[model samples]
Target chain A: MKRLVVMALVGLGLALGIAAADTPTTIRRDGVVLTIPQEKRAEVIGDRLRCLVCQNETVENSQAGLAKQFRGIIRRRVVKGETNQQIIDFMVHRYGIFVLLKPPLIPLTWLLWFSPAIALALGLLVLLLARRRRQQGPPPLSPDEHDRLKELLS
Target chain B: MATMLTRRLMFGLPLVAVAAGGVASYALLERMGRGTYNPQAFNNPLVGHKVPDFSLPGHDGHAGFDQAAIMAQKRPLLVNFFASWCVPCVEEAPYLDAIAKSGLDIWGIAYQDKAAALDLYLAKNGDPYRRLASDAEGRVAINWGVYGVPESFLIAPGGEVRWHTAGPLFPEIIEDQLKPALQRLT
Candidate 1:
């Protein structure tokens, strides 16, 4: 079924204007993980893991010795039919959450994750209050203040 | 009064945030300068967890030890990962020797090294490990969360990983972190 869907997508891409050679199913693109039949799942999982030695490169892109070992382990697990979650969890268990290329949302990262939205909300609130004040115009002047203003205008 | 309060708050909040950020940066810089912290290192998740299953063939002149051996240990010990080709491991030799001389057991795992190189490296530097093994495929090292050679783990009795360091263990580290950690176990 998955193969059928992938085949459909490839057909759709070819119809839409993507070259046959550029399609992911048939040919590997630059920075795309290796395209072996059994390695697709392993490649996806490895793409999210950081290469410790290279630091910036994902395990899929790094040429480091350790990255090669990671590729081996991930391929073995995927071939064994382990779920993607299990593979990612195993890496995290050994290497800590830092091994993840993209940080997961957790209690510690709550502020980091939500701060932009929080700031936007605060700005909209301030704008709403200011507009409300403007719509209300100036407060009704006290009798003495109204008389003084009238005398000054006359 | 309302305007004054608003003005004070507009100035005060950002000032407070900037001050807090400044203080944090200053403290981190000071610790880095003092050699008490490494910015590039992350906490190994295996700490406080049991050592996972692994077995490796014997290497060099020492017999191999496995997870069963680690579980049978009745006292705190060190699992030192070193490679014959790793420069930092050569730098860490004296510290390992010191730890061994202090009567604490050390189990060394040779990472991806040949027998002749291992024999030469140990003989020339000094053999501090009481028992030894080899992780020729690096599978065991990966399980142990070792990112690099010269990393050391302080394991508690029955194989609980207590602490780990990921560089050459200098004298200061041995005295400040490793010794205190061992003392706490005893």
Candidate 2:
């Protein structure tokens, strides 16, 4: 009886697995229906843009109406064979530098670009100060204080 | 005495830094609460650039104006991106009427709204736009780099985007901001 049950379960699993394997993996996600699936070519550029409405999510990941429209724009552009840089530049031309998820290196962004290095230098400075303090040992006691300390110890 | 001074300096410096940070945070939060400081607001790059070419279909009974229409205007035109679904746009409706009364041509773009709902919204609030267009897909809004609804762009007679505001237009904004700006440009 146990062997019969085990065989039935294995048969069911195999049937389900075969069905799953036969089904197509391609499909749209989150938004309006399009000819191409949501996770396709357009996402090459879409992945870089932030959805302004939802703030945290990328345009590809966001379900907001504006994000959907943005996706449509990107999909059409991608279909027209535009380069990723060209598409990104088009967005930048309209939305300004803030639209980029990864900010570009410009004169205004020098501080941002070098923040990690600045932080590392600050960390090193602190470590150096701490090491010097450790090396310096405790401050030398005054003669009167040393005498008082000896008396207390005795 | 020297050791005591150095010890005091070590502790006092961090305490001073913390206190300064707290005070700065308080001031910034106060400004935010008073609506004077907004971190989300960024400068529109389109300002001082010519208006991008776009032609949207006319919605309702109003005529849709394009880049050519704006170039032909002899006066400064306010291109307002609004939608019925946006709450701020409702607040801005009356102020738009006031601006129209003051003799500035106002062009309206309905961003991602249904015609039925938009008609109802305008009927209840007011419609002072000289021409109205529908941006059903929000393509044109993206082209204009509009971040949100109730955004206004003041286009100079020569077709440059002179000024832009990303929020509702209040009476004070029109009286103090737009009028002075128009006066300066014209």
Candidate 3:
């Protein structure tokens, strides 16, 4: 039993060690070194762009083959010394603003960005008005009603 | 009077809240039904842009594909990306053939397909393409922003992408969309 426990512990430790070593710190493809600040520019671009096929996921997180190809395109642009904006423009030109993970805050999207805050503000206003009305306590009972209350108590 | 006002407000506030909520929910449902963020509805950004430069190996006994040569012809062209395995490509092949017969220049980029498979596909579907190129690695298709097979782009005389569709080309699409665009191009 002692030997078995030792072997199990050794196996667990080795598995964890391997997993840690395998954690990717940088992206690579087919032995090409995608390093930054040069390659990091591409990484930033990838994170900002959405995968056309995956819909919900950014190109960086998507496992779709199209996403991988998009990343390759970004890397190539980065290697060619394209500026971040130029690279983004190229992608937007090819795939439209929808390809951007965060749609730009244009007139069309203003409501999307502000509606939550607007709703919260409206709720708070309603709550404050309701609380104020409650705090005022029902308008003090009229004098006649007070006399009637005294008479009933007697 | 104050009590009456307070009572009116109490009832009015809830009534207004419920009405507003109903209106808001209805609007939201309508928007959702319309697919506000639908990727399919998004316009192809390349529509107004020039077709990306590309060169690929030609299949079916055609000469090698060249972008400059195609643009030099100064005629409207249809560039279709397809693969042997894509079902929609098979469905749309006859329509493409019909359009080709109608004197429209249609070219095919066999996306990530082997030459043998492409030859077989063309043989089976009655080759509609004036020239077919093999995009074995799919690099050229990527340049054209093709994420799916059976996507077709209509290039204007100046080599600008004027319109695009992302699915099987049915007769209605050919008659309505492609025909109108072709008419405009001419």
Candidate 4:
């Protein structure tokens, strides 16, 4: 009976340890608690999203309070086992591409997508036009200078 | 006629010089603004200068991870930016834990993760970070020049960022690149 009780206690301890290992801790800061499952996929998702407040920052790097809220939102989605694209799409719908530091290419943002090429073309056109004007113009020479050069040679 | 030609040349020369100077200055300023001229630009070139003041709740839920305290120590440190949802970050997790176990001062900033989920991750995989700061706002990662997850930085005793490796670091990288860099930092 004593041996059985000891064995049962040890087994319970092992079981609890395993459970605790799998149970993720809830990190509470400033007024938010981010709950993440102890898994690999979820970690990646958190890193991919951009922080809305900090324009160039991904959700993972921004310290703005809004970033904390966004992270919480991502963590909830990850816990729900959403696919990466699904998670990203969900945020895109909520906040539009502006929330994404690296916004995906889509039809609605065609102007932003192609403006660089357009700007480059315009710059090249200006350079070519300037060069053409330079080529078309004749070199200036006064009559006296021209006559003096001819007299010197003669 | 010669005097007139000389006068014309003298007046025109200054105008040409001024125009040339103006054009050159504009081009230089444009290049600087676009950041095209500096081929080798650093994100957080300010490392070793001084670590920024960051006071955030730690992963453990009870304490604050102070940047100043971490910098005050003489030991070389490994600072990593990771997220729970990143695939590469998942792959690098165990390795970071291993590095921490090797008696090094390893600190982590959860780039953009929730506090609860981060806790869950550490509980499952094991916490390699002595103290993990939640960069739920990504403010710290930006300061650190982290563009992606699984980026690691090795800081020397004086707080200079000696080495920066971006991406999922492999075991061989640890043996070859990171270990050597850490050795040099110490």
Best DockQ among the predictions, by candidate number: 1
lDDT of each: 0.87, 0.85, 0.83, 0.70
**Worst 10-residue stretch by lDDT in candidate 3 chain A?**
A29-38
| iRMS, model 4 (angstroms) | 12.1
Each model's chain A TM-score: 0.61, 0.66, 0.67, 0.54
Residue pairs clashing in model 3 are: none
lDDT of 4 by residue, A1-154 (tens): 9999999999999999999998757654334445534234555665777664465676677786656666665666666667878877766544445555665789867888899999999999999987997888976779998999999999
lDDT of 3: 0.83
Q: What is the lDDT of residue B184 in candidate 3?
A: 89
Write model 2 residue lDDT over A1-154, tens digit each, in one string: 9999999999999999999998766555444333444347678688898887787788888888878878877876765777888888988888887778888999999999999999999999999998998999987999999999999999
Candidate 4, chain B, TM-score (2 decimals) = 0.70
Docking class of 1: medium
Runs off by more than 4 Å, candidate 4: A1-154, B1-44
Runs in model 1 lying further than 4 Å from the true structure: A1-35, A129-154, B1-9
lDDT of 1 by residue, B1-186 (tens): 998999999999999999999999999999777666888799998888888898887885688988988999999989999999999899889888988998999999999988889999998999998988988878899998988898899999999999899888888888899989998898
The candidates' DockQ values read 0.69, 0.67, 0.57, 0.02
Cα displacement (angstroms), candidate 4, residue B180, comes to 1.2
| lDDT per residue as tens, model 2, B1-186 | 988998999999999999999999999998666544556777789999889899998887999878888888888999999999999888778888988888898999999889999999989999998999999878889999997898999999979988888888876566666778888887
Candidate 4 lDDT over residue span B105-125, tens digit each: 788888778777877777876
Q: Once all C-alphas are superposed, what RMSD does model 2 give against the true structure? A: 4.4
